[model samples]
Each structure stands twice: as structure tokens, then as C-alpha cells.
Target: MCAVAAVLLASGASAQSGWGGGAFFNADVFRADREAWHEERLVVQRRFSAGAASLEGGTVSRNGFTDPFVATDLYARAGTRGYGNLRAQWAPEASGVPRLDLLAEAYAVVGTGWEASLGARHIVTASSAATLGTGSVAKYVGNWTVRARGVATLDETIAVSTSLSARYLFDGVGGLTAPFAEVTVGRGREPVVAAGGLEIRPSWVVNGRVQREVRSGFGVSASLGYIWDDSLTRWTGGLGVTGRF
Candidate 1:
């Protein structure tokens, strides 16, 4: 889910400045058939007093096809305690990727150190189109954060999935370091393996990552994940670098 990645990027260490830029690479390997997929992206962002905007461009290789795509996102504050994000993406003439995707969400601070959000997503591919709904709630306790999220597809057959995650931010002399873990279960589609010509299947995933501010305005992160679905098992890994000025 690109939405999940957007949320994380908005809250992670890279979001601490007026301007930021980053690059990321990720790979997934399916054990059942020895197939591999890869993705890379570059991001540029600017934060204003009441809002932020970002642009991303990337290439994805999957199922023996490669395509380039571009996406843009806007984040604005609704009030002192409410905010929202809107994103759109396009990949022209892509067969194994979404031809167009859009997401919109509104979030609010529900209570002290608590937040919640509701959102919707639409994806169109060369052969089919699907719409999905999403929601999430998060809590911040001292230097730790926990969140729960759910996604449901509203196609002919309904498929739902839930994910839970926790992160601890370590503050030190140079910068901040965060360690994160997440688990998801259900039949919902995961973001890792983009929904191209793939069908919805029951799946579970475990993911772990560490993000660190290497210097005052620079950061790096690494992630590893394992997924098991009805037909295949997959291993995924990712690396990212970001900078702010």
C-alpha cells in the first residue's frame, strides 16, 4: 500500500524539516517459484507552515515487466488538531502495474497522544479496477508509538486485513534512531507486492526495520520482511537514505 509508505514517511525521522529529499530501494523474492521483484524511487518534499507537498518518481520491475511511475502528495492541516493527505499516481501503459492510483485520507488527534484516520483508495490497471477503504489509529507513549490499521477491498468479494505495529524512538547525541516492528493478517492486499494482475489471497506478514539519523540532516533506514500467503512465501528487504535542509 503506497498509503502506508506515505504515512510512515510523513512521521519518520525525515519529516523534521522544511525541505527533504530521499531515495529508496526495495526487493522481494518469492520462494515458491524463485521470482524476484525490485523497486526504486526518488522523493522531493517541501513543508510549509500549514501544509506539505511531495513528488515521487520511481521504477518497478515485476513479473518480467518494468515500468516507470510518478506520484504526488499533498498534506494540509484542517485545524489545530486535524489534517489530511491526498495522493495520486500514474504509470502509463503498464501491464503489471497500476495505470492510475489515488488515495485520500483525513486524520485527527482524538485525545492526548492519540490519533485516528479514515481513508479510501482507488486503483486501476490494464485489465481491472478496484476500490478500497482504510482506517488507522495510533497512540504515542513517551518515546514509543503503537498503531493499528485495517484495509478492505470493496469488489465483488470483500477481503479484509488488519495490521499492528510498534516503534521506539531512541534519542541520542547525533540524532534519533527508531526501531520498528509490524504484523499483518487477513486476505487484504499488501503494499510490498503491488496489485497488478495478482488476486487477493489470505496472507500474513512480519516486518522489522530500523531508521537512524546519521547526521544533523541526513538519515538512513533498512528493513526486512517475511510474507506467507496461500500460494507462496516471500522475503523482502529495503534500504533508504534521506536528507533535509
Candidate 2:
């Protein structure tokens, strides 16, 4: 993966300065039965600008799951004078399960110290899957910053749930862009059914994550997660390395 990222960086730096790609591997170790699985991901991103409009596309592939999947996302943003910026994204998945997601967002810079955003998402999935709704708001404090984001899921098969995330960016700390920590908690139902027509109860889960920026285009992250259910009292740990051109 490192080799591929290096090659892409070199090529992009020498050419039209628009194409770049990278690869990643994520391994999770289950604390209950000592089961471990690894997932590999590949990402490619491109950006273009015309007048006051900009377009970007990122594609990702996830392997090592029971069923591998590919996802592609395209985003377009048009800049305005003072009010805000308009952004839209189209994300489609090809996992033999057929899913499409559309997201639209509007962000406005207020005064010189505050920004607010409102967004909506619509998802369609095969087999009557759950639908997701998301919203976010952010504010800048001094030069260093903090932001909060939230997401919700609603459907019959799964109970409603909400998650909140917070982040802070440390400025000039060893020339890092942002070093942050986040915590998320939510509740949802499990999709387990028995032949006797029994349904599993809902459960609450909590997770904490921490990440640091190592250099200009390289970083490392680790996360620990836990579930409160008796049968699902599993702790998971992960480590990841990322680089960009």
C-alpha cells in the first residue's frame, strides 16, 4: 500500500496535478472469542475547478468482509460572495445489495468567527434496510477550533438512534493540522431472528476514538469500542496509518 501511495504521489506531482490514490488496511481484534479480521481499502481522489465551482470525486473499495463492496462518491461545491457555500454529494455502492445515498449541505460563514451548516441525507437500500438522517453545526474559537456533528437512523427493523461527535484542532503543535479525540454513544436494535419467531432486544453501545497527525500527509489513529449487551460484550481495537499526496 505504501508503495502504491508513493507511486501515485510521484506521478501526480510530475503530471497534471489532479490524480492521487492510497491504500489502507484495518484489522479488528474481538476480545470475546479472540477472533480477528482484516479489511483492506483502496482510495482514489481527484479534484477540478472551473470558475467559482469545484468538483471532487473519491472512490473506495473494501475487501476481506464476508461480501466485499465498492463505494464511489462525487461532490460539487459552488462558492458564493458572503452568505455561504452550497455542496452536494452522490454516493453509490455496488455490493450485490444495491444501495444509493444522496447528501446536500449548505454552510455559511457568519461574522468572521462563526459558521453554521444544515444538511439532509436520503438512502435507499435493498431488503428494507434502515434509513439514516444526519445534521451538524460548528463554531470556531480563536485560531484553534472545535466542531460537533450528529447522525440518526430510523426504520422498523431497527430502533431509532442518535450519535454525537466532537473534535478539536491543535494549532502549531509540531506542525500538525489537527490532533483530536471523539466519543460516541448510541442505541439500536439487533437484527437477529430465530426459527421460533423471537426477536432480540435493543442495546446501547459506546465508543471512544483518538487520532494524531504525524506529518504533512501522514497520520496514525487508534480506536476502542464496546457494547453493553451480555452476548455482545466484545471489545474491539484497531490501528490505522494514512498518507496523502
Candidate 3:
């Protein structure tokens, strides 16, 4: 996790020249008998526009679930964890339309696994745009996961997005491939903004989330989720605080 974070920090410094960080917590309420988990993440990013080319990277942590076997049972256990990612962006001047943005990124769970993705961004309206990307990750021996996502912003005040991801495992331990999707709505202003999303994890889980922002460099968020496993169904929720300077 530390290595990933360092890589991200390095990417940010090498590309943009800015620094920022945030934290979040999640709780499951359905299965009150189980312990709730929390996660914290921080990032420092910089964007350098050198003739329409840019690069960025930063560190991230998810807390808990370090052991792949234990992480697989995340539906039952809770804890803290971390990961890292490196990304690059590029934009070239166009004749009459808005410039197009392209991005490529690589990520890893410290020592466990890694993934790579490529994406594109196109402005659809004055305050709205859309993004598309594809990526794959090595999860376990003979197991791999692929993800495709699309996100669109309708207005400066409201945004919506969704993604479809699939995973295949060689061993019988993992379930068959499935699709997942999510939608987010956000309202942004000078110092504060409110955002929320509903996520469906196919046969695994469903979640609802909301967050509030403060202009004083601090913010908080909360979420409630339900997990359906082979053994039982559970609910979880959590709250988190973040700051920036």
C-alpha cells in the first residue's frame, strides 16, 4: 500500500504540481452481528499541460482484506486496506470541436495483484461530458477480471454514471462471471457539494451512499449496504471525514 501511494504521489508531482487528500468510511447494517469496517485514502496530484500531454499518479488505501482469501470473504469480514495507481492523460487541439481527452492507468493492490486500463473523455455540453474505459486485473491463480465503464455529467449540478464488470476464476471457489452497475448524482458549488450513488454488485450486494462537503477544507460521508452471501444476508453502513490543504 505504501509503495502504491508513493507511486501515485510521484506521478502527481511529475505531472501537475498539486496535492490533495480525502478519507471515507463504510458500514453494513443488515448483518449487525458482524463487525463494521472503515477505510482511509490520501492523494497528492499535479497536472502538467506540456503541449497537450499530461501525467498523474497517486496513492490510495482501502484498509482490511489484505489476504486474498480473507478479501474474498469481504462479504463477511470488515477492515482497512490500501492500493496504488499510475495514470496518464493527453489532449490534442482539434479543428472546431472541443479537444478530446484520453487516459491510461495502471493499478495494484500493493503485493497481491495488478490491473491496467485505457479510457477516453469527450465533452458533450458546456458543463457535461462522458468517459469510457476498459481494463483487466489478475485476481488469483487462473482467475482474471475485466471491467468496462461509462460516466456522464448532465449539468454542473448533477451527474450520473454506470459500469459493467466481469470476473472469471479457474477454481470453483469463485462464482461465475456477472455484471455490475452504479449511478451517481452530485451537486457542486464554490465550497460545498452533495453527492450520492446507488450501486448493484450483481449477485453479491447493493448499496446506497450520500456525502456532504464543507468549504473549510473538511467533509464527511455515510453509506448503507446490503450483502447477500451463500450463507446469509447482511446490512452495513459507515461514516468518514476528510480534509484538504
Candidate 4:
């Protein structure tokens, strides 16, 4: 396989993956209860063979809800032993009431295409918390990918919720494209919402996504991303325009 083909194969055809240290921007818009809410997240990250460090900033605002707030997240991760990995994340308090949150998680890669993860969450301002931990599992079954995650919050106002999602990958559909669908059911305000989307990688180093969100209301989102690598040589720029990393 060529170098570019190797990268794409290692990526498992995921469009949102970055090769190494790079910058990525993502934005999300939500509509619920006849109100509009939006969030924009910017991330700068560095990834190595054994671990990674990432810093992310997010701004969220909604009508009739709390005022617009910005939050910072610091993350660090490392590989443990024999298919085990550890990760930690810190989100500083930025809400009006100011409650910091910390989460620690571990993941184990089982078999060839199965992964199990467990997480613990803590709210710095609350003496009371949730139960022991939350668990999730993800598996890739041939061209079909499956993921299910559940979270238990310590806050009394929020209920325990779990989300299930799946995607069917079309490796030979004229281009790199996949159709995905998700459904979430819980006791929350928007008890149930159904979403469907498509992730398309029309180019070797560029990709885009478009999705529709449905619940009590409806909305849509779109994003475009790009990535390139020149790590194979620093002086390739002087050689020619068609340089390879």
C-alpha cells in the first residue's frame, strides 16, 4: 500500500481523524423547545505513538437558558500495558454557579475489533456524587459499526441516560461515504430524538459532514475539514510541488 493508503486504512475510514499534531474546528447547533442553541469548539492537539495532549475551548449559548458561557478543557492520555489505555480530563468551572468537573477514564481493547471503557466523574463543588462508575462498549462488525454509551450524573435534576448509535460504511460507494443513524431515549426534556447523517471524504486529505437533527423540533449541521502531512522530509518543499510525506 502507498503511504496515503496506509493512513486511510489505519483511520478505519473515519473522516474526523487527524494525522498528528494539528488544529481542528467544529461547531454544533441545536434546536429544542422551540428555542435555538449553538456551540463552537476549537481544539489544538498533539498525538504521539504512546499518548496525547489536547486543549479545547467551547462556547455555548441558548435562549431562555443560562447566559452564554465559555469553558476550557485540558486533557492528557497515555497507553498503559497490553491494549490498555488511560485518559484524564479537567473542565474548569465557567457556569454562573461555578461547579468544576473532572473525569477519569480507562479503555481496554479486547479481541480485534472490540473495545470496553469505564469512567468516573466528580463534581468539585458537590459532596454527593453518582454511583461507582459508568461503562460503555464499542464494536466494529464488518462494514457496520456500533457504539452505545450511558452516563449517570450526580445532579438531582438530571436523569440517567444512554444513547445508541450505528453507521453503515460503504467502502465502494463511488467515494468514501457512510450513512449513520442514532436514537436516544431517556427521562430528559427531549425524551427521544432521532438523527441521521452522512460523512463524506471526497478527497484523500479532505472530508465533510452534513446531518439532520430531529426531536420536538428539527435542525441541521454541516462541517468541512482538511489535513496534510510533510513529516517525511523537511526539505521536500524545495524539491517539487508534488511532494510526498
lDDT leader:
1
Instruction: Please provide TM-scores, in order, for all candidate models, with all chains considered together.
Output: 0.86, 0.56, 0.33, 0.47
lDDT of 3: 0.30
Q: Which lDDT tens digits does candidate 3 get at residues 1-245?
A: 11111221111112112333344343433353544333333333222222111122222121222111000000111112222233322222222121223333433333344333333333321222444433333332233333334343333433434444443322222110111112222211111101111111223445544434455545555666665552235665655554444
Please give the ranking of all candidate structures by lDDT, highest first, separated by commas.
1, 2, 4, 3
Give stretches of model 2 more than 4 Å off. Answer: 1-22, 27-38, 47-65, 80-106, 109-116, 120-126, 143-148, 154-159, 171-205, 210-216
The window of 10 residues in a row where model 2 has the poorest summed lDDT is 6-15
Look at candidate 3 and tell me the lDDT of residue 82.
27
Q: Please give the clash total of every predicted structure, in order.
A: 1, 0, 24, 0
Q: Judged by TM-score relative to the true structure, which candidate is superior, 3 or 4?
A: 4
The residue-by-residue lDDT of candidate 2 on 7-55, one tens digit each, is 1011001111244444455544445664454455555655333112223
Using TM-score as the measure, the top candidate is 1
The per-prediction CA RMSD against the true structure, in angstroms, equals 3.8, 8.6, 21.6, 15.7
- Model 4 lDDT per residue over 1-245, tens place: 00111111211333323322212223222222334334444434333344434444445433333322233232223343122223333333323212344555666656677767787654432122232245667676665556576665444444454555454454411011112322222221211111111111111122333333232122233444332222211110000011111
State candidate 2's TM-score: 0.56
- Which of candidates 1 and 2 reaches a greater lDDT? 1
